[model samples]
Target: MTAIALKSTLWSLSIKPFKRKGGTNLLLNASDLALGLRGIGWNWSQVHLAPETRPTSSKTTFVLWTLASLCLHIPVFDALHYAVQSFGPTTFGTINGGSIFDDTLSPLLRYSRSTFISFLSGLVIYCAIRITYDVATVFGIVVLRQHPTQWPPIFNSPWRATSLSQFWSKRWHQLFRDFFVGVGGVPMTYMFGRIGGVLGTFFISGLLHDVGLWGMGKGSDAVCMIGFFIMMGFGVILEGFWRKVTGHRVDGWIGWIWMCTWLLGWLNLLVNAWAAKGLIGSLFIPDAQRLPVKIFGPLS
Candidate 1:
């Protein structure tokens, strides 16, 4: 329901006509117009009929690839899900068994545990999104008879990102690119310049995320969501400053270290906020259906 609402809202805000073939289309009747708008709303990335080099894969190959991806991701997701469940929901900074904020533990142990949980939560989210994208791509190509080009890979090796700008713009899934740029980036660019545009886009992204949390009855925390995103925007700006001063782009091992430190260091703002609200207890896959849970039982 949250997704549908958000997508519908994005569609409403879209200025361009999301035709399968771009440009003007003749709508004979109200039904045609309605269906056309519905189709546009359904296409999250607004993919259309466009010429591209990548050829469509065989049905057999597609099935095998998707299956392999699921085989790899399912177990990973299940393990993280089990671990998250074990931590259980935090209540007023306390948990049933243990927590990242447990004062009884040493400072090193607490920080390390929090960082690990944050990393696990991030991976779990990535797996869930990737699996969903793969299944949806298959359904679109095989069942709906949509062109494979319209369903390009949703992600492009985000973990390899060496810079904040590269991570957000090039590597990460750009499903919300158009929406963010159109609604926030463009206007801010006109008003205050490129820096403002970057900050504004991140601000909107943070706002939307917190809104989603609020819609889910989790009670939004602006400090967690908005603060994290704004800090990321500043990180991108700082990288730009470094390049200007040093005449060297942020890349290689040094860049990777800096990126990891920035992300992981600030990640707790979002992760701990969700954990406090019991979001970590939410299960992605049922325990009875998880192979690892069946074989080895839940994590201790």
Candidate 2:
């Protein structure tokens, strides 16, 4: 089975230890190993024919992406985020550099606003990333003159996701998928069962995310983020059951609603906790008078 194969691969990676001369284990922070393995430089040794045309433009892709990033960083992204929270029954605003948890708002309204802001945040981020990728890739083709034998896709229309499995495997980016699989998913699948892979992947991701949250001053809310991911793992399991029982996965508007209920709806906890702890503040530029950068920004 696929799980068995993954388990074997994980075992092999575990036993085949490689260490830096300075005694650092890159595996400890799996990102390093994953990046190294996935980087084009690492795989370029393989034989491949170069593309016939290596083209780049100054005005089209790169310029547009730079402008988009500017808009998101300057006005639109943070402005929209602030407007959503303020427009709601509760402001959830920053006061004296802290989050004011206004209780005047109804929970339904609060959740709705949170969902809206999160949606906007996600949309801006997606656009930013896509544009950034476009800029870098075009730069490579034109400036670096590196001919891509085959260009990998930037995304797979994540909105079309019908199930958590499809979302994770197909819709979502695969950059960190290998990290979870190699680090925990495989062993978990072997020890437990099919669901083990799901749980293991999610839990490992949760820990990583918790670390990130803690770093962002959300140490108090890190547990919420971890729980959020574990909940997603469980949701994935339930989706699997739905497919088995109904002879189809949740799809169409129903599927979208189901996915959003858990993914976006459940996100309220993490975002609320994060907002309370001033963690969300780290994400955007300060009010018009300020910017996202700070003293520790370089190190962060």
Candidate 3:
């Protein structure tokens, strides 16, 4: 009986789309439209809230974000060192001294003295850069008495409390998710079912992340990028399944799980940063060393 029910559900989902010609395209287009509207709505909301809190002029915000972006890159480069050093000496030879490759194990292993030092250096540099960006952004907002949302030309927040959802929804790369879900997810869901919608969204996001990394001359970063997509895809499928089984929605548990996962991932990254520093002294500094550099380094 259960098997038959499962088969019936699958058949219904798969065949229904074929029975309606052009329906898939139509639904997809609708999703795209919905996403666009959502984006506009979010932007409008930000604008509406902006005047009440701070200056309406976004020029100063834009300038700060631009500076923040440049500063952010310094740590990103340092993070890359840990990622790169994880490949070890053999991979280095294979790449002709170029720092690129997908080696998952190096980060897991105990570090040598030199490797540790380098990783620590890189980690410190990265942390310093990140801290500087955060502090500067906060100070600017407070001094100008301006709303951070009005800050344009910036993609993400420098402060904490930013979640994946919130970050996607408001702070960093606003409307990107809306556009993806609107353009790809909603349509795919209607045509192919929720699974399709989820997968479609995940795939597009992964592709974009990969492209961004590749554009930065970090093509080897694809491994982690792909891993991220896989995780998200699984997450989507699980959420859908949970909803179906419960005959309603499942968010709180899912949200908690997502947060836990994100934190764990971040912790691992931090550990990797420290390990990298231990393995290669001065090659990278851990997050701890970020402060002094930000304070002492040349200020823009």
lDDT of 2: 0.56
True lDDT of residue 89, candidate 1: 39
Better of 2 and 3 by lDDT: 2
Report the alpha-carbon TM-score of model 2 versus the true structure. Answer: 0.66
TM-score of each: 0.80, 0.66, 0.42
What candidate 2 gets wrong by more than 4 Å, as runs, is: 1-79, 84-102, 124-145, 148-153, 217-220, 283-300
lDDT of 1: 0.68
The local distance difference test score of each candidate is 0.68, 0.56, 0.45
lDDT of 3 by residue, 1-300 (tens): 322332233335443332322224565444333432222223222211112233346747555554566577665655554444444444331222332223443654423433443344334444555555456556546664434542433333412223344423343343245445554566688899877887776666665655644553323354455566656566547656766898855445556556445534433333332332232222345445654335444111
RMSD of each: 5.0, 8.8, 13.4
Clashing pairs in 2: 285-292
Q: How much lDDT does candidate 3 score?
A: 0.45
Error of 3 at 38 (Å): 8.4
Q: Kindly list the per-residue Cα lDDT of model 1 for residues 1-300, writing each as its tens digit.
A: 433444556668677764444423344232333432223323334322222233466655665676677778778877766665555434422322223466778989877877877787788778887788778767766775555555666677779989888788877776666556666777888999878888888887888777865665757888988888889888988998899999999998888889888888788787777766656665556668877678877544
Clashing pairs in 1: none
User: Would you list the rank order by lDDT, best first?
Assistant: 1, 2, 3
